[model samples]
Target: MKNISMKNVVMGSVLAIAAVTSLSANATPVCSGTVAGNGASFSAGTNFVKVAFTPKCSANVFLDGEETSPTVFRVGSASLKGKTKFGGSSVGGSVGNMGACTGAGGVCSGTDSAAAMTAASS
Candidate 1:
């Protein structure tokens, strides 16, 4: 009975390790994209690593950091600008990251609008 229990423990440990390894291997945060009826689209990375907006609109996407400069990604018709929340860490995250949009030349407003903007926040 003792030997059997030891074998069971070893098998359980191995299986647990394999499960963890497989999960980690496939663990990737997903990015987000938004498309408007006017043929505009917006996309941003999960960890604030990348941001893309459509129709050649200029945008700045970033994670909140004291010494880091906000990186700009130029998008097209629909522009997307995002800042990770005060305590948040991801770009497209709901709780921590905030996204705002505006139209070219300040015509449109909100994410639903077909505008572009640059966002900077502390």
Candidate 2:
């Protein structure tokens, strides 16, 4: 996959799982954190990546910027791999051989440096 600059938006409910697939390049995916909720994890393979998250309803966040995938928020899992803001400011995109993905909703893994932002929840 190749990294492609894009501007996308991911909005959905925070009481389940949402998968936002938006990355064409197979590089290391990074993100940040702002709000808190349920459990969220990230995983990357050779062909694709998985973002398993569990929202619990809290606040609204507007990732005013590049967004990949169509924004999937369920209770099981989701994925991204094309071009966008990854997930939010806390979802430390997928990285090498995968990292110790965090399940905390209001936290970042990489360099996304997340702030106390707000997003619309369902």
Winner by lDDT: 2
lDDT of 2 by residue, 1-122 (tens): 13221111122321112234322222222221335343233343232335432234222222222223333211111112212222332233221111112325422223221111112111
Off by over 4 Å in 1: 22-122
Q: Give a tens-digit lDDT track for model 1, residues 1-122.
A: 65344323322322322222211111221112233222123344442224343321122211111112233211111113321111211232212112323345432223322121112222
Query: What TM-score, over all chains together, does every model reach?
Result: 0.18, 0.17
In candidate 1 the C-alpha lDDT for residue 35 amounts to: 32
Tell me the whole-model lDDT of each prediction, alpha carbons only: 0.24, 0.25
Worst 10 residues of 1 by lDDT: 22-31
